[model samples]
Target: MNILITGGSGFLGARLARTLLAQGSLALAGAPAQPIQRVVLVDRVAPPADLAADARVQPLLGDLGEQLAAGALPLADVQAVFHLAAAVSGECEADFDLGMRSNLDATRQLLEGCRRAGHAPVFVFSSSVAVFGDSPEQRLPEVIEDTTLPTPQNSYGIQKFIGEQLVADYTRKGFVQGRNVRLMTVSVRPGRPNGAASSFLSGMLREPLAGERARCPVAPETAVALSSPGNTVRGIIRASTASSTEWGARTAVNLPALTTTVGEMAQALERVAGKEATALIDWEPDAQIAKIITSWPSRFQPKRAQALGLAADESFEAILRDYVRENPQAVKLAVKG
Candidate 1:
């Protein structure tokens, strides 16, 4: 089997590629476990050295359009497609044109490409919690369930919701075997801040660990649903590998997540990294970021995802511990007797 991962150089994409390579085989619906012959990774930037050097990994270093046109996407042999590319929330809200191009148009093209391939490939789309939001009439419930309708409030949310619809319709038309997942705000991502309104969720811990100053855009009391990257990647893989009959009737699932407040996350950080590290965080707020983050529902009843075997983290402390383990050098050890 051959796999194609758009935005293959991203943190998740790269991690997924590494995982697939390590596993060596995939068991598809109603088919025997097939060896992965090739994994084509498409992104504007290059992947890490080890991943790029692997014989199975074929990196197409360019934009999606350019790579697709340049025969980088293995149309005929690609049995699975993980569409992880998109303009994130902050970027999408800031630039409408870029968001449409990256999120909507690119996804349609990928689906069409799969259709044209003459094989109904397993299409896994990475959607977001942004798909649900507050409108003028009523407020979104404290705990969002799968049955609740998506009422997007931002351009990014609208774009993601539309993408979900397209995937559903494409599946309905038998163009592709599609499954989309609404990801929560992935906390404790390792690196500098990006434009995402929820980036601070990670930064509140990530920056402080590295002895760098961090900013908290939202208040300490602000609570939001969060999932660790390990759990998220697990969910992604499961969504793509489930049997056709077991997959839900709908084309999307709201992934399970733990509800945690910013204060709790900070407290966890302090527990692990100490009071000095916690002091690195500044309590300055950004109205734009706060508004966007506040609009998102902090709790969920992702029944479908739970049934499908995807799980959320136990707590923010566990999440922080996982981060510390992954980056031991980033955190200072507690003094011993």
Candidate 2:
């Protein structure tokens, strides 16, 4: 199977590509006749050096929106499309035009390209929980089923919601097999910060454990829904591979996971990394970030995602432990809170 992953250079996209390559090789090697052949990485910037070394991997550098507009993407014979490209919340909120072009227009172009391909490729979109907007008057009824209509509050959320609709309409028209996964804020990301409003969620823990100071842009009590990077990737891949019959809704479904406050997360970090790392976090609230964070839902009961076989971390401590295990260097920085 030929696979294409847009935004393949970004943290989530890069991790997913790596996972696919590793898994695809094992799965293909076991098959006597049918073998996975190629994986394409498309992004404005080049992927990391390690990914480029894989023989089966092909990295394409260019503006996806422009490329799609000019009919430049080579979509023929491609079995699946993982559309992870987008302008993140902070970036989008900072620059409206960039958001529209990257998030909305690019998606439309991609769908059009899929339609023009003449084959129904499995197109999996990485959406976000931001589509929920501020807490509803009734507070989501403790369990948000698959049928809830998206009530987007921000420009980024609005764009993502639009992208989901486009994917659904394209699927409904039999042009593509679409699956959208509404991801929660992924934490313990290993890398420099991107412009996501929720970057602090990971940064507060990641940087401190790296023996560096990390800033908390919100108060300790500020709560948010979260998932580990590993689980988020699993959910994305599941959406791509699952049969349409199994995927009842063309609309996006939230990935089930734990919800915690900044204080709880700090406590988890303290438990795993020790007090020294926790002390590295400086409480300096940014009103802009606070408003955005406040508007997001802190708790979610993703019944459909659970029934669909998606899983998540049981607690913030588990997530922190996984991060430490994945990044052993953090152990040296562990100190008492």
Task: Name the best candidate (by TM-score).
Answer: 1
Q: Give the winner by lDDT.
A: 1
* RMSD in Å for all candidates: 1.7, 2.9
Clashing pairs in 2: 274-335, 275-335, 275-336, 275-337, 276-335, 276-336
Per-residue lDDT of model 1, residues 162-247, tens digit only: 99999988888888888888889888888667877788899888888888888998899998899998888888888888776767
lDDT of 2 by residue, 1-337 (tens): 8888899988888899889877863211112323457878999898888998889888888999878877777787687889999999999999999999999999989889989998988888889988876655635444455677677778899999999999999999999989988999999888788899999999999898888998999998987889999999988877766666677867787897678899999998888767888889999989999988878777776777887688768899988888888878655684443
Q: Each candidate's lDDT (Cα)?
A: 0.85, 0.84
Model 2 error, position 7 (Å)? 0.5
Model 1: per-residue Cα lDDT at residue 93: 88
lDDT agreement of model 2 with the native: 0.84
